[model samples]
Target: MRLSTVILPIHRWAEGQKIWRRAEDLGFHAAYTYDHLSWRSFRDGPWFGAMPTLTAAASVTQRMRLGTLVTSPNFRHPVTLAKELISLDDISGGRITLGIGAGGTGFDATALGQEPWTPRERADRFAEFVPLLDRLLTEGSVSYEGDHYSAHEARNIPGCVQRPRLPFAVAATGPRGLKLVARHGQAWVTTGDPTLYENGTPEQSVEALRGQAGKLADACAALGRDVSGIEKVLLTGFTPDRGRPLTSLDAFVDFAGRHQELGFTELVIHWPIPDSDFAADEKVFERIALEAPAQLR
Candidate 1:
């Protein structure tokens, strides 16, 4: 029943830093920002680089873990990302979690002037990317030649502060993606189906999430992996049109309780903005901070 939030880097560095510090003071277990060249509706709006923003956040926050909501193979080569991540882990004193995904068809997908890929092609690239990234982070002088990515004697000097490597919180919904979670992830994250949230009742959304978890459990079973070790994180503030948004303490509590029933170990809500998709009263956060910990714990 842990709680966390995502703070979009749409503000100046000073304001963003203040939010990061405030999030920690508010008792959030983790804080994140999206990793993208530019996001969907916010593409034309102000945004900052995920790594640099997180680096600055790490310097200011003491206990809360920090990371991108999800990084992907859309633009970054794993070797380069691995190097940057190891350095980030050092900066955060082992408090960095890499939330990664197979990528989606968005502004980031074509922002780098790359060819569009089908879902199958994206999955294939992700399959190669995660393993290579895993090897580079945990082993030394790794070399790989995959269909989409290659590393030539990539050296991981000084490795990561967190034992084998920094924790990987992999996002997945489909079977193949779930397989990656079973194989490499320390945590599994889901937002359920956005369309389901849009058209279905709250109960239906919970059912859909449960079904997704069941698939992930099956994926782990196939690999003889223990599902209990993997943390389950549900991103509650997924779509604006979802039934009864988490706008206040009561809404968040109800939403979190439902997901916890579905076996989610962590629940993430997005910070409110003045005028945006996740718009809400910011005071709700203060209420949650003052009241949630005792009840949730």
Candidate 2:
């Protein structure tokens, strides 16, 4: 399976920038980042906007796919989004993947000044939103009036560097979400839990991830899409202090094999970017960037 590293997103924005540089130097397959207005997880502080950061990352890296792990309609009007993405595609020479989703979590919508809707509603809204964006990116012009978005001769200025539109990926986490992933995305991502299970094994979390992968595989076949069209990724890697006490890498490799069996062309490893108040924790970013490529290879 191919490999990519999550851009050190949580905190230390400058350090995250450095981590991006290091990962590119090590030859990771792609550099993935995300946009989130708020969160107080292990990684915290001001979050850099995805597209601009990607544009900056684009300038520095010569051969890595750049993407927002997921983008949403709430943050951008379709036309405005296409404009920025077009610029990015041109700047990056077509090396961009557009991963998108319905806004997740109440906190995200609250930040955006919109009420949080149920997952079903979010999915339905996305179904409306993505096709239009997809159309604009591919056709370079659009005319449509929908319940969510209306476009009157929307034009994608100068067009994107990637020809027939960029690869579309969906980051979903459930049954209905899996259906969305199958229909629209060229990639699907899963989260990894580092906690030991009741059985004193990491297998439970790995199994959960595998189960999600299986559902996506079935959904892809049902929807008449090639399973290979979608790449599957896994995240939450924190396996550093192994005294043969519990190798995290083993679990990660195991999960990859499972997802590969279920039809994933590539796996992007995401690491927790710890609560960045400490310098030590921040250093983990460098380690993750360095080690990910070796394992992926």
lDDT of 1 by residue, 1-297 (tens): 888888888989868888999999898999999999888788888999999999999999999999988999999899999999999999999999999999999988898788778999999999999999999999978988888899899998989999899999999999889999999999999988788655666777777888999999999999999999899988766633352545667776767676788889997878877777777777877687667756765
TM-score of each candidate?
0.97, 0.80
Please report, in order, the local distance difference test score of every candidate based on alpha carbons: 0.87, 0.67
lDDT of 2 at 105: 68
**TM-score of the candidate numbered 2?**
0.80
Q: Which candidate wins on TM-score?
A: 1
**Candidate 1 — what's its lDDT?**
0.87
What's the CA error at residue 24 for candidate 2, in Å? 0.5
Worst 10 residues of 1 by lDDT: 238-247
Candidate 2 error regions (>4 Å): 9-16, 42-44, 192-201, 237-262, 271-297
The CA lDDT at 119 in model 2 is: 73
